[model samples]
Target chain A: MDTKIKTNNTTSEKIHSSENIDEQMLERLFRQFSQEIPDDGFTDRVMKSIAAVSQEESVSQKTAFSLKAQIPLLKSLNWFTAILSVAIFLFAGGPQLVWNSVFAPIFSNVTSILPVSVFRWTFDDWLVAFFRQAHQLYSIDVLTTPLPTIYILLAVLTALAARRLALLTV
Target chain B: MPSVTDIALVLQVVTIGSQRAFATLVERHQEPVRRFLRSLTNGDEALADDLAQETFIRAWQGLRSFRGSASFRTWVMRIAYHTFLDEVRKSKPTETLDSNQRIEPNATQTDNFMLRHDVQQALDSLSEIERTCITLQLIEGQSIADIATISGLPQNTVKSHLMRGKQHLTTYLRNHGYKD
Candidate 1:
């Protein structure tokens, strides 16, 4: 290749000391540089890589498809679990066991922490006390003062709407 | 074969994952692809071939996305250009042609080694975009629209690059004792 280039260069130099710079000359020079690159197993290597890539893609696709296909099965299993739990709760004295093992302990812990008089009050008494506290804090019967209640309700709704809008914007 | 169109080959590959069809496409376009990359890499044939291989592989994987609005060769060359750009971004090599590797193809003889050398050196004198535009326009015979598509440059920008790049090459050649 070197010898050939040297011979060509010698011949071209002998023919013309310097070729005229023209559009044709520029194209010719570019063509000389942009010769066809011989494919010395380039296609083979590319094909091999493509084959490996395809295999990897297919494997991942198959795994993804399988997972997608299992969605219904997983959903069905969820329903089955719900039904089984319901059945066990109904047929196996589940409520009593739960009350004894869970509610009783939790209630005991709560009662142990609070005053005994707090739990002694009826549901009506608790409700009355809550209303009395609200009336005391606001200096009016909130139920009787519908204007304040409505304004407060609107303010709460507006605040909630503003919070929701802020969240969406963020 | 000459009878089989690129679209037909591409369809076969897309529909059935035909390696044979893709292989034909690769072989058919590898020369221009490699040549384009070689110019971009300043005649580093090994790097050019590696980039070419990657371009073909990407073309194979992305065959489905090819809408055939452009010719398959153009699409592959676009891939090759992007692949070259990605390498450039990763490497962050010298900005000027003067700082880059010298142009030397491991192939057939040229009529003037100094002219070829001067041509590459002149190309190196331009900015990367200008060099790309010049190489695509002059060497690869790509049109302004096609060059824009390949390089993701605006048509006007490509035009300016070609203009500036050509002016630089003309000046360099003139300075190096080439007349007219």
Candidate 2:
């Protein structure tokens, strides 16, 4: 009821039913433009939309916060996958290729300080078995070379898939 | 009396995401903003209300930037004015001359329907600037300075637009047998 069209209502009231039309009538008619054009629930509609927007804002914000909370775990998983791939490649006869240039001193120190038994039944043992299996496969002329690059490629592809899956779901 | 302080208090509440305060502002100001847009839209109520809704949404987004240099109503009206201008500008490049700019000779009805339709036709006949100036001045009862503030035109230019717009409407009404 806020936007009552004061123009048509008030105009006929203020102007006598005289046949003569003056500039005053014109002014009055124009003044009708200023009259409230009765909203008929327009405000309610606007307020409803406002409330909907506020609700949507809160909901989306909560969703975003939840998404942010998932990020650290996703990142850790990504790092784990990347590290596992690197570790597998390193132990699978790829270390000799990098032994002198990269891993010689670090390997020597690690072997000296760590007992051989400590590496059993863990990822280290898995790495050694994986290399042994790969070496046997290569020795039979299945691969004329020690192909640690394949395991490295697999590791990278695994990390990439994990990264993509994380992104897609979240 | 909706005092300035009360309005300012509501505005402050709105800044903190108070829906009630924002609704209060909308209830208080929606009439004038919608009417102003109605005039701009040539009585296209739906278009006018859409613009009004957009104006309010923009106001809500940018409420924090309101420096209170103008009355809150004036501030909203100014946004309404620019919103109309922006809509017009965006559509201008694609607009063809309204194919039927001339009125039908058969505008002979004396009922409220015809009067309202005739008024809409008269409003649509004016140039956009003239219609804007006349609407702000005559319909909305705003002073020339306030019209300048809302429409972002110089006071003298606003006056000239008002004069020319009124003259055109006078002629249009006279020809239509709407009391001279």
Between which residue pairs do clashes occur in model 1? B97-B124
- Model 2: CA > 4 A from native: A1-23, A32-35, A55-170, B3-6, B92-110
Best-fitting candidate, measured by DockQ? 1
- lDDT per residue, candidate 2, A69-92, as tens digits? 898667666667666865576556
Question: A60 in model 2: Cα distance from truth in Å?
Answer: 5.9
The lDDT leader among the candidates is 1
Tens digits of per-residue lDDT for model 2 on B5-108?
Answer: 64665566656777667777887888989998988876656777998998988887788887877778888999999998888777752342241332233566
DockQ each candidate and list the results. Answer: 0.22, 0.17
Ten-residue stretch with the least lDDT total in model 2 chain A = A14-23
Task: List, residue by residue over A91-165, the lDDT tens digit for candidate 1.
Answer: 465545666677666666777788576554443345457666877998756546544343444345444554455
TM-scores of chain A in all candidate models = 0.32, 0.35
lDDT at residue B38 of model 1 (Cα atoms): 78
Candidate 1: Cα lDDT at A105: 66
lDDT of each: 0.75, 0.71
